[model samples]
Target: MALQFDATEYAARLDRLTARMRDDKLDALLLFAQESMYWLTGYDTFGYCFFQTLVVKVDGSMTLLTRSADLRQARHTSTIDDIVIWVDRVNADPTMDLKNMLSEMDLLGCRIGVEYDTHGMTGRVARLLDNQLTSFCQIIDASYLVGELRLVKSPAEIAHAERAAALADDALDAALPLIHAGGNEAAILAAMQGAVFAGGGDYPANEFIIGSGPDALLCRYKAGRRTLDAADQLTLEWAGVSAHYHAAMMRTVVIGEPSARHRELYAACFEAIKAIETVLRPGYTFGDVFETHARIMDERGLTRHRLNACGYSLGARFSPSWMEQQMFHTGNPQPILPDMTLFVHMIIMDSERNTAMTLGHTYLTTAEAPRALSRHPLDLIVK
Candidate 1:
């Protein structure tokens, strides 16, 4: 079995979840997030795109309701012994199987928690689930329950994160040489991803953001690639993933002599990120971190180019995004806790000036100061 953690760690995590469940007065949790399942039981599979769920009873029993494809998957990758597979047929609604399973488990009238906010639970699946079990049980949105528990990394998880961070550094090493003038986006992307694979790392939760020329202003990955100009800027946001745990890094590399505006924006980003780090300790909140970035960017008159949110929590995540529920955004009262892996970015894109500058990296939060996961310096990459 490819269990990410040992038996004791899994047991401790189960205990923590059950304890949290008791505190929240929840009888069971319908964990729809694949990350939640992986964290709790080392259940790894991309089959979460289908109608699958892990039902966790507060009594410490866990049963995974998935398709036949993941039946052996659960057995091999997870500690979950009780695996039930729902038959697939035309117009099949797996929620019926879930409802029947819940009924058998005597969860029919209990206060059940459903992870409604995750991509694993689609609106169609959620609606079917609600119609099938809402009247049968007291269902509530407990999407963040497991997420909150997974926020603080355990010693074992941090080890994986550190390994992932090393792989990210390796990727950067592979990309730096190829990021100069006339560089091929395809080559750079492949080199970066290849470095991770060679280092025994897993595929990242999302596509690496790669754009050059005017596209360097983009923070998101899009179709089509272009060669780097003689004097161009390239932005990259990629992660090193190990056992699905991510340690992401972002940067904007200058192909030639950086323009005056590029230098200006880079200076602003550097200062903003450094200042934000000062408040990354446990005494502050996630909002405090973003406010720190906002204050610096606004004071420098770069507010329009700056992102509304500086960064977000990172963990073992599934497709569509690597960002966790907790984010560094204004009005978010989530406290900055130690052992949390966070990815804070400083993005400044001035389309008017046709320039871009981005600086970001993941950090493991500590009581005093957050420790940077990446060993790479935060200096502007001028090739």
Candidate 2:
């Protein structure tokens, strides 16, 4: 049989989301974000303007409202049978259709849980609704409630992640050969992207971070006119998403020969990552991982200058709070559980050598242990 997404799995996820809303005494959940839309329904469309609105009823039934132009795709992609299309004329509010649809569906007066952050439900939208729907209904923030459900992974989710990680291995296999002296970063990225496309990846969660030598220290540098030098360390932190499942991989490379100090530094970071992974399993807090890394690095006299979080959950799709919230790094005590997928990244910048090194890989948590998906050897390659 041809591979297909499980509608039942999507239904189960909706049930979980609804149960959370019910436990909180919320009548319905208003899912209006890309990740939630894709999570609730399988509908994936590329447009930042046409907000995909979903009012998940307490009974587990949902009504998805979107632009009329996208109606067909929504119906085709979503598991939900009920869909609403809104197409209003000039000089008229577009959300009028939404109001009418909710009213017709008897959802106007319900105690709704709003995904305010994702929907961009501005104060104006709330005020308009306050004057309109608030006569019968109440709206409260439901993002956190819904987010709690997606924080873990399921078996099917792990399979998708495995596929994505395998694709990353393939992309690296294709791009590794391009890391020669004077090799342009842009060309290497193109080669890696081509490999991802060839391996059936739609696109990467983010652009491939292909940095060489000094540029690698910046972590998020753009592909510029710089070319790889024989003495420089070529670092890559890239991944591709398959069926909305994402996997990340980070590797460091050296063209020709690397100095003994460079090799020793890379080995320290490598050992640090391995030491963390050695004891990684269920029931450990994020704080434990942080402390473990600190202890390991202290032993080696290495500094963690990349502002990297120990790790975070990964699966299904890239959520709002990704891999420990890079911009605002906060530690979570949520114990790692079985079936949860995560990425533990060790990006170390050696100030003395003016070079940075990265060792990142995705893992699937099991009852017994964590499993690595990428088969690429962890040793530093001297191309």
Candidate 3:
């Protein structure tokens, strides 16, 4: 079995999920989030780009409805015994197959929860499910049900994250030396990802964001790569993944001697991260952390250059994004809890000066304080 955790751990996760289902008055939960399925039953697969769903009942029974490509995948990677394969054909609808499966489970006329916010559940597919099941069952949008449960990491999950963090640090170490004048962004990115894979780590959920010079001021990954200039700034953000768990890291490296402005911006961003770290303890709201970041950046007069949100939750995730549901932003009421993994990034993008400074690392929130996952120093990296 390719299951990462023991049977007992998976069972406990399912139990916790079913308990939440009962509390939400959900007779059955139709989960479309790959993260939810993987967290609950160790059902890891990249087959979620197509239509698929994991149905979990209040009685603790779970089943997966997926395409034929993932039939063996489900068997080898998950604890799910009853796996139904939805065939592919011209103009075939998988949602009808899902409706039939729900009916077979005696879910007709029952209150069902559906994960509407996930990538797996498209609007067209969702409408089809609603049309097919509306007469028999009440479909409730419980997008955050499993996600909320997964916010806090278990001991076993934390262990995987710690290993991933170490791998990320190693990746940075391998890539930093390559950030020289006339260096290739592609080569640096390749070295970074290669380090993670060679260390037995999995591919990250999203593409690594790598840029140099003017592109450094941008955050999102774009098409085409550039060669590093003699005196340019470069920014890299990538996560190390293990068992689908991710620990992300971000750093800005200067190819030549950094200017005074560069040092000042890096110092401000680093201080902002440090300020937030001090308050990342149990009983603090996520907003409190963002507020601290805001105060520090505002005090440094870099408010215009900083991002509105400083950080977000991190966990086992699939493609499109590595970020988890909860985020650290203004007015967020989500409380910081023990065992929650957070990726806090102090990003200061000054388009006016054509410079970018980002310092980010993953941390595990403990009862007392948040513990750093990446062992690398937070200071500005000038190559």
Candidate 4:
């Protein structure tokens, strides 16, 4: 099996999960999140687009119900042995098969936890399961149960995150030189991805966010690309993924002499990130970090340019987004813990000036202080 971690590690994760299940009075957990399944049993596969589920009992036993296409995939990538392939045909119902599986495990009348918020559990499929099993079992939304458990990284997981961070730095190093006047955003993006793969890294959960000119002010990735002008700003947000673990980084580069506004905004962004680092230690709530960013930006009169949230937790994730559940935003009560990997981005987008200044990097929370995973300098790069 191509398990990402050792058998002992997988076993320990199962123990932790089952313990949580017992504490919640859950007889079984219906896992649909790829990240949760992978974290628990190293079951790595992209078959989540279709209907798939992993039934994990409180006794630490697991059975994967997937289409036949993923039967070998589950075997090769995960420690799960009892795999059941559900056929797709006209009038075929996988949920019925799932119900039978639960009945066989004596879970038909038990309290079951379901990952209702995951991409794998679509509304249609969830509704089908609910309609079929509501007469037999009690279904509860346990969406963030496993996600909460995964917030803090284990020692081995931290090692993978650190390796990913190094590759992220290397990607930035290789891509920076390509950000010259008249450079192509597509070409720079290609170089960035190539650098990560050349360093034995895997594709990130999401596409690399790369943009130039006015598009630089945007945060998310778009479909098209543009060419850099003689005097323009370019923003990049990408990650280095190793064994599906992610360490993301963001930077805004100037292709020509930066304006005075750019200098001032970049300075505020740098100071905001520095302030964030100080409060990222254990005992601090995720909200405290966002407060720090807000206070710094507010003090600089850049509130209009600031983002609603500063950062979020990072880990092995699937597509649609790389962000995890725990986020650095106002009113969030989640406390920072040691071994947690966070990506804090000080984003300052001045639409009035049509300029963007963003500086972000991943950090590993420690007892003393948060340690930066990337070795790159946080200064604004002006070419």
Among the numbered candidates, top lDDT falls to: 1
Q: Please give the distance, in angstroms, between residue 129's alpha carbon in candidate 4 and its true position after superposition.
A: 1.7
Tell me how candidate 2 scores on lDDT.
0.70
Model 2 TM? 0.87
Residues 48-137, candidate 4: write the lDDT tens digits.
999999999999888999999999899899999899989989988899999998999899789999999988888899889998899989
RMSD list, candidates in order: 0.8, 3.4, 1.1, 1.0
Q: In model 3, what lDDT does residue 187 have?
A: 94
Model 3 Cα lDDT, one tens digit per residue, 1-383: 88899999998998999889889999999999999999998888889989999999999998899999999999999999999999999999888898888989999899999999998788898888888888979989999999999999999999999999999999998998888998999999999999999999998999999989999988889988899888999989999999889999999898899988899998898778878878999878999999999999998888899999988999999988999988999999998999999999989999998988999999999999789999998988989
Cα deviation of 383, candidate 4, in Å: 0.6
Error of 3 at 263 (Å): 1.4
* Candidate 3 clashes between residue pairs 3 or more apart in a chain or in different chains: none
Decide which is better by TM-score, 1 or 4: 1
lDDT of each: 0.93, 0.70, 0.92, 0.92
Residue-level lDDT of model 1, residues 69-183, one tens digit each, is 9998899999999999999999998999999999999997999999999999888898899999978999989999999999999999999999999999999999998887788
lDDT of 2 by residue, 1-383 (tens): 11236878887888888778789888777776666777677777654244457778888878887777777777677776787766656754545666687777787667878776543355565555446556657777776666567667777777788888888898888887888898888888888889888988766545677777777776664747578886778888887668877788887787778777667667776887787675567677666666676666667777545444655566554432223221112355667667766777777787776867678788787776788888986788778
Ranking by TM-score: 1, 4, 3, 2
lDDT of 4 at 74: 92
Candidate 1's error at 278, in angstroms?
A: 1.0
The deviation in Å at residue 22 for candidate 2 is 1.8
* Predicted candidate 4, C-alpha RMSD: 1.0
Using TM-score as the measure, the top candidate is 1
In candidate 1, what residue range of length 10 has the lowest lDDT sum? 175-184
